[model samples]
Each structure stands twice: as C-alpha cells, then as structure tokens.
Target: MRVDTVGAVFDALADPNRRTLIGFLAQRDTATATELAAELPLTRQGIAKHLATLKEAGLVRRRRSGRETRYKLTPEPMTDAIAWMATVGGQWDDRLEALRSHLARGEH
Candidate 1:
C-alpha cells in the first residue's frame, strides 16, 4: 500500500469512536450501523458517518441485507497496520538498546 493509504488507516484508528467500532466488529463477524450506535454514545447517523470514513480507508466493509446495511472489519488493511507498527517498533527497540549500552558504559 502507499504511504498515504497507510496514513489513512492510522487516521481512521485515531478516533476513539472509530477504534471502538473496529474492536466491536473485530469481535463479531459483522454488525449493522444501528446495532453499533446503540452501544455507543453517538446516534445511528453519526455511526454511519464513521463507517463511511472507515470504508474509505479500507478498514471496514458494508453490505446490504434487505433494508439494512451491515458493516464488517477487513483484516487485510489491519494486517498492514500491524506491519507498520512492527517496523516502527524495531527502530525504537534498536535505539533503546543503543541507549542502554551507552548508559552501561557510563556506569562502569
């Protein structure tokens, strides 16, 4: 994925409401906007808006069931997200180890 695409995924997760929705859908296979709104403080419309943003970022998918629309998590982008974090994590770990080694030398 492009850097812009990866940035969008992280931006989508930056919101607490969006994060909660992701976690909820991750637990279940899928859920309707109405179902999710009932659990959160926002209205159903608000949830729909969040879903729209998530869908745009390729994090969530929507499907029609008769008159209702259901949303579900897409793991592909999520996996990419984990990979980005691991990349950053490896860099941080290396820096920390070097810092520790430098500090140990000072203590000796």
Candidate 2:
C-alpha cells in the first residue's frame, strides 16, 4: 500500500467513534448514517462526519439509495494496511531474533 493511503487509514481509525462505525458496517452489507446513529449514542450528523472520514480514507464507500445515502465497507485499503504492517513486523521480528542470537553469544 502507498504510505499516504496507510497513513490516512491509520488517521481515520484513530477516532474511537469511527472505529465503532467500522465495526457496525462490518456486520452488515451496507447501512445509512441514520441507521448507524440509531445503534450508537451519536447523532446522525455525527455519524455522517465519521462516515465522511472513513470514505476519505478509502475504508468505506457511500451510495445514494433513493432518499438516503448508504455506506458499505470497502476494506481493500485496510487489507493493504494490514499487509504493510505484517511486512514491517516481520522485519522487526527478524532483527529481534538476530539480537537474541548475538546476546546468546555474549558479544559486547
């Protein structure tokens, strides 16, 4: 994934409300902001704002369904972010193993 895309995903996820919204969306195929608001303590407007951030981060997609806008999780950006994290984590793990080996050899 591009660094900026990953950064945006991380930034959008930094908010607890947004994370909650994501969790809600994940359980369904799509949902309206109003519907999501009903499930949470937030107002519909607040839910819209969080959805907008999620859309910008490529985490969700919105479509106009007759009178209301519906949002569905895109998930591709999140998948990319997960792959990037795994790569970085693997590198760190390798480095840590090397350090462990060095320590075992009692090298200064």
Which candidate's lDDT is highest? 2
The model with the greatest TM-score is: 2
Q: What clash count does candidate 2 reach?
A: 0
Off by over 4 Å in 2: none
Q: For candidate 1, lDDT tens digit of each residue in 1-108? A: 466778889999899999988988988888999999888899999999999999999999999999999898988887887888899899999999999999989964
TM-score (all chains, Cα) for each model: 0.84, 0.98
- Candidate 1 local distance difference test against the native: 0.90
Would you list the C-alpha lDDT of every candidate in the order shown?
0.90, 0.96
lDDT of 2: 0.96
**lDDT (0-100) at residue 47 of candidate 1?**
93
lDDT of 1 at 80: 83
Residue 70 alpha-carbon offset, candidate 2, angstroms: 0.4
Candidate 2 lDDT over 1-108, as tens digits, reads 799999999999999999999999999999999999999999999999999999999999999989999999998999989999999999999999999999999995
Candidate 2 TM-score to native: 0.98
